[model samples]
Target chain A: MDHHLILRVVTRLLVAPILLFGLYVQFHGDFGPGGGFQAGVIFAVALILYGIVFGLSRLRSIFPDRWVMRLLAFGLLLYAGVGVVSLIQGGNYLDYNVLLPSAKAGQHYGIIVIELGVGITVFGVMMAIYYGFAGRPPSIEDTDW
Target chain B: MTDLAVTLLLFFALVSTAIAIALLRSLFAVVMLSGVFSLLAALLFIAMDAVDVAFTEAAVGAGISSVLMLGTIALTARHEMKPKRWSATPLIIVGIIGAFLIYGTLDMPAFGDPNAPVQTYLNPDFIARTPKEIDVPNIVTAVLASYRGFDTMGEVAVVFVAGLGVTMLIGGSGGFLRRRYRETVLSRKDGQA
Candidate 1:
């Protein structure tokens, strides 16, 4: 895989921009055609592209399995935690009105935070799934392709 | 109209790609064709003005899933083995299911009909109130995260659980973790010597 100099160079150039786009989608979701799900998958695609071009071992070193597992839980907890905070604030579960002084402000803040949670979980899950599949020994060599 | 023409063309392409994927024995080709199918569907969604759905279909469906399928092929067989006997029963079952699905759609309203039950009911309320209530430009995000927060939380939970399942199956003990642990141990022992 390393012998393909062109592939490696192109991947290096593209990965940062791809990740930046994912963040843009994640944050700009309220105003645009993206949210946690799309942004998360896009972010995962960056890592997956890097993994494919370089190798799984290099990918794992950077995105350790332990962090992936923890973040997977962290995102879900963050989502639920938001709901609980709303409940504790004397609003219904997940009611964002109480999260801030103004109802609109709360809605804006709540949506952004929850979407971030969604983004994280999605990114983690996707990368985990890719790792799961690619970590298995390949039956055929690269030359076979 | 141009929109109709574009949609019909994309739909025809989608159908052809689906059939091609069904007919192809090569798993790799099937995966690639599925990605093409996702792209076509994404284009169709854009034509219908559902930009959010289009974005998701393009990114996850065409992008990540295709790559994942290729990774799967790397692990497993590239070509699907032909069944010893081509059975008519499975074909008959599929035909019956397809017939029922088509029949189900027959009762549904035409695409984008303003009077459609879906467009008439709760949607109007959301649209009218979203600006003042949520103050967000994208009603989809507002409804998904705040108005219908529980459902979205459930969806996130489902993804979390799915990741857990896959990690259990492929990340623990007999998987990458144990193997990496052994390598580290061996390296540490050699370093100490």
Candidate 2:
């Protein structure tokens, strides 16, 4: 009980900073020590921390199944949006210079946008996996409880 | 002095960890050791100047995968299951394969050699062509999203398939059986502690 108490306390305290760092990493990937994948992991880790201490019930409220599915779709949509934006601007699919008025800035913008997509999808996938495993079918043996 | 000592201590800690993993019987210990090994491997990668691979390993291996495994562990602990011994044959087979892999690494370039075949071949082309062809300053992104797009697609498919499989197998709500593991663990705690 004490161990769980410690875990709960630590998780709540640390989750905020982990999330902030993830955002920072996502935005600052092109210039710094982190990127989409790293940010995704950090973001996922924070949630995992919450799951570890509090159980799956807490996570359900924060990230319902429907919303998580949508987040996954949203990530892919972001990536596809970039591609569509490029197509409309007269370049090949996924070509990013079409993202902005200026070609060079568009490239950077495109990378960041794509990275955000990757991060969201990854975060969603991680949560979905947690949900799939942590949530399971009932059996006769479980009736004792 | 302090920096050198810290690296050396970390290396020593890693060696002891490896030994502990080799000797331990508990599955939780094994999982924890694997996380430690992955972390050590990440540090080794960083030391070798493989920042990209290091980042990937640290993120996936240490952060996400560890969390996933811990969740799995917690769920299983709720149920009372007999401790079955793991088969040694599989372990032996894996050991032989791992030995061969280590041997293959020997034939590769020496650690951090500037003239390593990998660095010489890939980095030069990446440095040159990224600016000219892709027009993306961050060459790794260009290489990941476009140049090696097929690989990324494969990874996405792998994730999709896994989630699909899990959803298929588990199906519907996780009510009692899911909580069983936690209950058993709590009972065990009450009994033992």
Candidate 3:
């Protein structure tokens, strides 16, 4: 991996744009053909690509496992919390119509918040799975590839 | 005509890739071929005007899964182990199931038929009311996030549980419980000292 100068350089160049694209997909989902699940996977892909190219240790330093686990739970909580808030607002559970003064605005806010929750949870899960698989010592070497 | 041609070409590519994956002994090549197969399926989804589905297939099916498979190969063997003996039992079972599935599809309405049950049912309602109610440009998002919020919540829960399960299983020493146990032991040792 150290000898692959071109791969290292290209990976460095590509990581930022990949992350930006993932954000675009996450936010633009309402108007376009992407959403939380796709966006989350795309976001994880940027980090996974960096892990594969640079090294797992380098990737972990930037995104520790503890943070990954926390984010995983937090995302689910955020989604469920939205429902609870709506319930407290006198709407039924997950009833977004009462989330705000305007029904349309409530729906918009609820959808965005819930989508963000979905995205965060997905991103965490993907990264966790990657860490689970990649954390194990490889039986095969770099030369095998 | 061009759409039909592109679809047929993609279908052919998908089938060939599947065959290659089955025949190849090298696990690496098989994994790569499966990714290619997923990409072809994504292209087919696009041709069918299911862009959201296409995006998911391209990202999760082709991208993440391939990398995971490669990680698995890194942990395990590069080449598949040859079967101890050729057995027709599994093949026969698969063939029967495939025939039953094809037979089942024969009774279904033609693809994209306006009169089909799915097309005539709640789909039209969702399409009709999405702009007025949810007011999102993407009907799919509105339906998934708002109209079917509970189902999406369940899906997210499923994803969360899946991550938890995997983290508990193959996560090795990375498990939170394991780390806590280690910390407790270290504290006990310090107290003893």
Maximum-TM-score candidate: 3
lDDT by residue for model 2 (B1-193), tens: 8656766777888888888877776657677778988898888777666777787788889777776665566556533344487678978998999999999998998866889988798888877877765576567776776555445545654554555456545522433443575689878999998
Error of 2 at B8 (Å): 7.4
Q: List the residue pairs that clash in candidate 2.
A: B78-B180, B78-B181, B78-B182, B79-B181
Candidate achieving higher DockQ, 1 or 2: 1
TM-score for chain B of all predictions: 0.86, 0.66, 0.90
lDDT for model 2:
0.71
Candidate 1: regions farther than 4 A off: B172-193
Give one digit per residue, the lDDT tens place, for model 2 in A76-143: 67777877888999987877766788776777777778778778877777777777766653211322
Using Cα atoms, each model's DockQ against the true complex is 0.65, 0.30, 0.74
User: Looking at every candidate separately, what fraction of the true A–B Cα contacts under 8 Å does it contain?
Assistant: 0.82, 0.27, 0.75
lDDT of 3 by residue, B1-193 (tens): 9988998999999989987988899998899999999999999999999999999999999999999999998988888999999999988998999999999999999978999999988999999998898899999999999999999999999999999998888883557777887799988999999
Off by over 4 Å in 3: B172-174, B180-193
Ranked by DockQ from best down, the candidates are: 3, 1, 2
Candidates in order, interface RMSD in Å: 2.0, 4.8, 1.3
